[model samples]
Target chain A: MDHDSYSDAYLKGVLEDVRTIAVVGASDNPLRASHFVMKYLGDKGYTIIPINPGQAGKEILGHRVYAALSDLPEPPDMVDVFRNSDAAAGVVDEAIAAGARVVWLQLGVRNDDAARRAEAAGLRVVMNRCPKIEYQRLFGEIGRIGVNSNIITAKKRPVKPTKKLI
Target chain B: MSEKKSFGFETRAIHAGAAPDPTTGARQTPIYQTTSFVFDDVDEAASLFNLQKVGFIYSRLTNPTVAVLEERIANLEGGIGATATASGHAAQLMALFPLLSPGDEFIASTKLYGGSLNQFANTFPRAFGWKAVFADTDTPANVKAALTEKTKAIFVESLANPGGIVTDLEAIATIARDAGIPLIVDNTLASPYLIRPIEWGATLVVHSTTKFLSGNGTSVGGAVVDSGTFDWSKDGKYPALSGPEPGYHGLKFHETFGNLAYTIHGHAVGLRDLGPSQSPFNAFLTLNGIETLHLRMERHSTNALTVARFLESHPAVEWVSYAGLESSKYHALAQKYLPRGAGGIFTFGIKGGYDAGVKLVESVELFSHLANIGDSRSLIIHPSSTTHRQLDAEGQTAAGAGPEVIRLSIGLESADDIIADLAQALEKAVG
Candidate 1:
């Protein structure tokens, strides 16, 4: 798949298909962006599984934590990697072994090799992007920061009907 | 532009929120004078209204030019986000709006601007049903004693206006932290150049950009900078930020935007309803004024110290209350908070009382007898007769505006020339 060819339709399709996201290296610290993203996605009605070996048994924002992606009872629809770029490859491998359908590297965390490996293994890959920001952008939210999103209309968009896979 | 944080204060002042117009290549930020924005279609409009997207719908909420100023002030203050308002009073209202509801109380320093004192003491209680408990913040113990179950926030000024006294922000901030409330510091006098309250543990900093920020005293504007440090979700005391907001479709700001919740809520809810939004033109002027803030503040401090020293030695001068003066009670506090200088505004007591205070205002040649401060040209006012007339005699004295007191806003003039003007004025007033 062409990296630059990840169009709006493709991104939207992935977002609509994914139900549960297992976040690697999730933290309980509210100041951390990972914590915010986890809470934001969870508030948006997504099941968020926090993967932190250091805080495996503890709960963050009321979601039970897992030691690693492998420790999950079932495979997540998406594996959101919150670790640094160097640590992304290991997380991506774990996601692949867990049979996750999508591997997402959080904003500022990019690994070309990991992305390539994930795509070669028949999993979709997103790098250096945050799902919260993307959701806001695709759903027409980024305009408040003064960015031109190009899609402007006075009429409200109908909420897309959700079909729960779980 | 890319390495924004690495840039010096001066560089960031000029370039932080400003970029050349992408379409027209205009080097300056354009004043978007329109009242409302046109959406591409109904879907986009719906998304903006739903907070599903971010864009301008109406000027009553946000505007492009004001957004630039907001971003610039936020960057300069080392804050995550900012909300700009029509005036300093409006900024104060917005700053407290998201933090207080009916029957909710907040502690405020008694040493505040006369206008602010009246607003906090009377208007907030009568109009909004929010009570403001005035504490003699010269000591942190007074503030600690004022806290109750109803307390939601603590307010203070980095440098008390007219009085020229500096606050012990760290002491107050500690008290606020222990009480689980946000410490809101009015940094109008200190600005970001002289002191940053956030670095001293203040959760938020408010500024009357009309003063030193605009430097020219040209525009009436204000800003609130969120350090994004306070935990609004800690015990859910601040339901406006942590819990579901009924106004915004039951959206929880803290859970949704995290650290940026205060500013986002201020813009989305406070500004949306209050309608005290800043004009783009005012924002543009304020932004232009900010570019030279570092330079102007330094000069303002130096000139003020010279003027203060001159007044301290004058025969007709009963006393002076500039923190830069070693004899001042606030000298130690000024040293801790304002290492640069004690700012440009100070008050002096005339030996002849209120009549002489009036004479000085009428006698100054170069200084404009006005209520404004932070101008390139000098300004003088008899606060007892003008700004603080509404306050009782005791309130006037407590706020540092005694009957014999004359306030001076030192400007960027030749030190000798400014002192010469004051000498001539003092001679006439004393005689």
Candidate 2:
């Protein structure tokens, strides 16, 4: 539970293992970063249960909203917190209570105390990172943006959709 | 990295798409000059080809340097994404490629660059079987009337070339919205510094980066910015986006990418097949030019206003068609859309006619007699004899390039120097 950088293997493992993501502070507004991330993850074949207290009964990007992580129909595999650091502590506590295997704090939403507490509860933690960007990066998508992806090959390959069990 | 919405235009222009080279820590964006990138493995290479991952495969498809330029332009224009191409003409073609198939029609403004006119009237219809019905967009009714079941998009320029006519973008956008088609605005002359077309309800914006966006005229490049607002999947009309494609295992782009469908398709399919890709070096130069866009555009606007005013008062000038001038028909529209100033290019009729227009071009010492606009150096052209010479008299007038007209692209020189140079040239032509 050291607060050092997570390796590519660790990130890729987390992404492959997680099935459902509960996006805290999700909004219906398309301009919001949370909304875009929810839509992107959903398109990538992840089950997204949007968590926004203000929009508990409504729908965002075709997913029913939950008032909080506790209100979800079932425990999410990963709790992706989009709220600020102060709000993130409460969300991290909820993630532990809900028995989420991984607690992910989105870009700029980091709290060391929360990370420590999550680790104490035996939960894997990712802080201050976007899951969508990471999924593309680890899976060889970021190479499109000119980032150096360590993998290199001359042969063309078809992308098979990742196996999903909903 | 924080979202770019918090940054100012100037700050975004300098840093939006650019970050220090991850490998070298080089502050400047390095030109990844290679034709192809080495894929890490067969699976990684397959993922890139499948569009399952976003990474460089080929230079004709995407380059890192060009990607930065695309990101910067999209940031400046307030779009979701962008695709950079070989030239402005290519950008126009790319913008319409996915939307229009054979026998489909699109409404266009008559007040467009003559080159665009030729492409739309001649090339598009003949080669692709796509027809462009030009409507006088001075009235919004004409745009609305031009719409038919076959129409897919409504195209116009924010500020018409040569004549400096500022379009009533809001009114035209309303027409485009009612018709449920994307508003494709060619913002080449205005350069986002004067106006952002997306703010006025444009679905997509195109730019001739060869002009003011490059600022120095050192490179020829173009960009297409997707607003990500239009719902291409709503109607069955846009099949290329909504329907499954044969290219990538029946992948529906709109369903897959959501807001980024058009731009993603432009990169994945349009640029991939057309091979009209901008060079990484050109993108690097254009990115450098954009850093000083705010400063250059301001000076260009102010200098243009001074020149316009001087020409309006000059005895040798018959009329000036600058939107910045109070007497211009497009003055009110210009104020609403381009409050900064009415851009740096405009046309004026000389006292004597076509011969005097030619004389004026020959007499000017400081202003370069050339076909190009939006350079750091002032440029003068008698479009009837140059850029629009291919068009007939009726076509010339429709494109706003009459025989007596002389187009001027005001530069960032001293206002007094620009005025003095024009005045001397005018006297030589008329005397």
Candidate 3:
């Protein structure tokens, strides 16, 4: 599924097995790009959530609003979407019926038959990518805003995983 | 950060664009010294004045300490973001303000920096009719026979200032990618620690973060970077980045900031209509002088190749331009684009000519007759009596500043006390 080139080890194995995302067309109008990628993925500690069917239950940076990814209270290891590309084909079928295990899509959202029906229901898709610019281009955090997060190396960056995962 | 690594370059130069003070954890980067930014209402100040979000609403178009020295010199020049200005001639007029337009035409490199050939042959053609031409780009076929059709961009200097010329960046980046135009370079004397003009393909890099990425001699500032791989909407010929911005409402900056459209239109319309920002206390002293830019460019390229092999075995010297020497004719394009060295500035000549180059920069006593160049101590000048004393004599020998040159900038000091203070200032200027 070449949704326009990926493989930084399949986007660091779907952003290192996500860790709660949701976002959908989330916004509280902080001049929406899904409210600045949901306040930059809730200021990087993730667990974001938002969703917004018109701010379903209100609240954005403090996470709450949920109108679907089947009104989540639990199931959300990633769904991102930020709708468009025909509402990311029904938010990739409600993120494979609200049990998402990755589906991403955001930066100018794409669909490809809703990413082949969310990889034939086992989820994990990604498409027009932008999990906050791929978790700041895979953890180096967009080189603190000078961009070119085209990953080089010599190690030393890690320390981020705050918590989440069964 | 293994998952197959990435971060190096001295840990992205002491942690790229920094972190820590997300409000008081303040591990350094703080000079935000106010001038606006409070918003949180009026729809976050009309989404930061309709650029539809990307915070900061002032300090001349963004500041958090000059956005961490414009994202630490766009992450030490790999690029894709950067702006920081107010010098290096406002980063070469904000890297030609989103690609010229008043009767466009660009193409520089006549071995630049005599105040960038007097701001491109007299202040960008008398304050913006934007012309520039000049070529001799050390033969990239005289920059594709100085291209025309109102050229639009090519500029160089990946290690040029004061001659030791080296622009041939992948043959003028393959003639600005087969003339689609946009090369830019100026990497202030090879400063992505000795050249990173967007790793040789260059599509804008500019600097002069007051020479050598603020490696001391207190910041004057400047940066441009970008290299978001220019496409600018495939030859629509940069209508200020593929047309539409009649002051943001028509928007369309490369169709909404894809690859951050020319560094977000160089801070929303060239530092918001040319204000030339950069002063969160000189971007916090050029971000602590770029956290020791790789140990001061390896002791300023080993004290400028030991003061260019002591003025090429001086006996009052007569020539020594210094592309890390071996009789430099840009010594194999400085070992294929500055293979880490050839950098603490160069230039020589002497054996008494223009009054022994104004008596060896008024007889140096530990250099510093300066008109400035990546300083840390040693410095000197004399270009036909001080910075190409207003060009002419065929623009000071086609900008190499001839008339018995002299230049030098070598500065992490002690290379045998900078070759015994230029050997007693060449025995009192030509013994």
**What fraction of the correct interface contacts does each predicted structure contain?**
0.07, 0.12, 0.17
Error of 3 at B225 (Å): 7.8
- Candidate 3 TM-score, true structure as reference: 0.37
- TM-score, prediction 2: 0.79
lDDT of 1 by residue, B296-336 (tens): 99999999999999889999999999999999999999999
Residue B62 lDDT (model 2): 91
Give i-RMS (Å) per prediction.
Answer: 10.8, 11.3, 12.4
- Per-candidate clashes come to 19, 12, 3
In model 2, where do residues sit more than 4 Å from their true spots? A1-76, A79-98, A101-166, B1-5
Candidate 3: lDDT over CA atoms? 0.78
Docking class of 1: incorrect
Candidate DockQ values, in order, are 0.09, 0.10, 0.08
C-alpha-based local distance difference test score of model 1: 0.85
Where does candidate 2 chain B have its weakest 10-residue lDDT segment? B1-10
The local distance difference test score of each candidate is 0.85, 0.85, 0.78
| Residues B1-431, model 3: lDDT tens digits | 33444566777777666666643666777787988867645754764577644657788888667876787778778787888888878888988988888888898888788888888888888888898988888878988988988888988888888867887799889898899888988878778867787777888888878876776778787888887877788868888888888887567677555677788788888988988888899878878878888888889888888878878887889888888888888899899988888788888888878988888788888788978888788888888777788888888888878798888888897799888888898898888
> What order do you get sorting by TM-score, best first?
1, 2, 3
Choose the strongest candidate by DockQ.
2
* Standalone chain B TM-score for every prediction: 0.98, 0.99, 0.38
Better of 1 and 3 by TM-score: 1
